[model samples]
Target: MAKVKINQPFTLLDTRVGVAERQTVQLEVAKLYTHTPMTIPIEVVNGAESGPVLMVCAAIHGDELNGVEVVRQLLSKVDAATLRGTLIAVPIVNIFGFIHKSRYLPDRRDLNRCFPGSEQGSLGARMAHMFFDLVVKKSNHSIDLHTGAIHRSNLPQIRGDLSCEMTKEMAMAFGTPVAIDARLRNGSLRSEASGLDIPVITYEAGEALRFDALAIAAGLQGVENVMRHLKMLRGRRRKQVHDAVIAAATSWVRADVDGIVRAQVTLGERVSKGQILAYIDSPLGQSEEAIIAPRSGIVIGQQMLPLVNEGDAVFHIAYFAHANSIVEQQLETFIDDIGPIS
Candidate 1:
């Protein structure tokens, strides 16, 4: 771990943050049509000692709010005096979409798909450029938090480019029941950060526009676990009740008919090939169809909304080299460990 100079100030966004200090920097992203300035609040906690710089950010999609709460809870618990390195927490990246409770920017562009952007580009591009240049570039490591899209829920899982050893280690240290070897999408923050040799991981859980206690709790624990693993926090790493199992690939099961779906299996449930996962019934009750699993895998995400159109993605299953029973047991153990969420 690299150490910061003793008593030296950590500089970010052109501001000097002294050691053992907590500061909130307002990063101006844009101005509203009403002429009001829009800024993203970045909370920086510079610890007393030198260590790695870890950035934990959320709400890139704006409505994916479980991560916002995770960042909030994390910020509440992190003490600068005791922290080993600098912790940069950006709870909301897309202020425009967050205010509207929508996933896309006002221009209808997905902010997440625009990364390492250009100042001369579109609205999403400009904001992405500023954020990446000012916030993300300063970090040694990063954790991007997310949740399923609207009316969808995801089983807590870690997604990263597992081919990278550093990313794989962080993903495993996150202690989720499932870790996916996801491919890097173009213009994604993970891809941009990885290009700079900064290992980043994405934590997916809960549902967009809703807060899930289990997901929030698990995310908090996962962030802390990674901190310990990175030696940013001084404590023996907590042994996971069930170590995360890597998924070789994931597939989404789409609704076969346009109707109201009656799901037979829930998130984290293990299913066999051709198993009946859901039944779709027409609104008039005249027609019905069974949605079966294309292959045997563990359910990592599913549609929470009952109504679905034909070809709408319903269940997301991840295939693993290990026994499905093992992953099922890991999910069970994780749920038990977290207990009931109120």
Candidate 2:
């Protein structure tokens, strides 16, 4: 494939960032009820040479903060003079939710589901419209950073519609131990980007509201890997520590009884079908129920909080074609390679 030359200055949010220059732009999206202005902070790094424009954004859910740190660390290491293309980094997309330390907007609507939004729609829609039009559409490719919901933790993984060749390539380039061939959710940024023919892959890691060192380190490395894959960063291709295994399907194991959960499995642990993952016991210790895995797979996600209600999801397992034991070894090696990230 021939590389497209992009020597011209990159324009975003009405600001022109010249080659070899880095600029931080404050994008006004909405106003707070107290009359204070709310803006999404964005940094554009226009490279010295020509390559694909890649957008790495995080905190679309506000509380999913691992990605914010990933973007921060990634920007710290990127030098525009040595870069081959543009890097548009948006650290926080939902200012309102971030301020409140919640996952939804002030209107209680999910910002992620409001993509390709209308200018005259609700607050989420309007903010989504501003972000989608001004930021997302300006890129040739995208990496959406995310984490599990509140009180849940996800193993480092890449999720995308792997049917698309470009999306699959980006997922593999991300180098997660496991990559889920996920379906695009309607109204999501990925879905809307696909409409415009933009290849976007989402990186899911850690838990919401808190930062995990390993997750953050892996995320930072994954973004750099993708950038190198796109030739936006100059480097001889670094091989993935472990070749990412594509999951055939994933399902959540729900608790059959409401109680405090005593989890027996950890993230990345391979479990056999019908194996006990967690035991839900009553407060008085009079009753207990074991939560069993419905299928043999790797535990990709699980609820962090011990308490759960009936039918609450406790574990997320991903099925693969490879032997579960081999996947477990790959996961162990990947974690050891990352080590402690203090």
Candidate 3:
């Protein structure tokens, strides 16, 4: 086994937290026009024993708050004194978007797409560089928490490049019933992390700027499960997890007409080809339309709001070859396994 120096101070961003110590380190991202500096808050828990370093981070989009809560709850359950490795929990990654309750930086740029950025780049790029340089480079593995964009809710699932053995292990260990074998977007954080050979998995659930207890519970449990798998913490599995699918194909069902929609199915429901997924009713006329599933798959994502424009995406479905009645029951039980919020 590879060994990391133990019983010593863990220095990050020039701040030192000793082994068996849990400390919060604040990283400065930028300075406001008022000469005030923006900062990203980080919690570092270096274990007494030597093991792989894992970073669980959330809220890269700023509006994705479910992950924020997940990281908070995860920190509460971990004790640094007994931890075998190191954990760096960053609940808020996009400080600009988070403070403004937006998914974009002040410049309206997607912070997620700017990675390993330059110091003299755009605000988004600079911020991404700061986090990657300070947090990501030091970690052996990571989990990037996320939620569906505004007006959409996602069934709890894991998304990443499952072709990588390490990534595949993390996704399976997450206990989510569905997993998307997502491609790495250009300049994305996951892409940048993968470039450095660090494996990362993204957990998507709930909606932006909102808190769903089920998503948070699933996220927390999933993180704990991953830690246990990595031997960073000793714990019992939260539930009997089943195998997850590397979705063979996935696509979004777009609106056929501009109108208000009434979704016919809920997230996580299985659908057959040509099945109606939602109904759109125009406010001014009788131009009602039925949105049908283009292929047989599970409804992994859907718009929460009724308002829509023609061609707008309404449903995200993923096709799995082995999905059947048995898989459907597993999804139902998985939701219940996460437990209640209060």
In order, what lDDT does every prediction score?
0.92, 0.92, 0.89
lDDT digits (tens) for residues 1-342 of candidate 1: 854555357999888899899899999999987989999999999998888899999999989999999999999999998898899999999999999999999999998889999999999999999999999999999999999999999999999999999899999889899999999999999999999999999999999999999999999989999999898888875655556999988999998779999999999999999999999998888988999999899999999999998899999999989999999999989888776677
| TM-score of model 3 (CA atoms) | 0.96
- Compare the candidates by lDDT and give the number of the best one: 1
Model 2: per-residue lDDT, tens digit, 73-103? 9989999988998999999999989999999
Pairs that clash in candidate 2: none
Model 2 lDDT on a 0 to 1 scale: 0.92
Off by over 4 Å in 3: 1-7
lDDT for 310 in candidate 2 is 95
Model 3's alpha-carbon lDDT is 0.89
> Order of all candidates by lDDT, from best down to worst?
1, 2, 3
Span of ten consecutive residues with least summed lDDT in model 2: 234-243
Residue 109: error of model 3 in Å? Answer: 0.5
Runs in model 2 lying further than 4 Å from the true structure: 1-6, 237-239
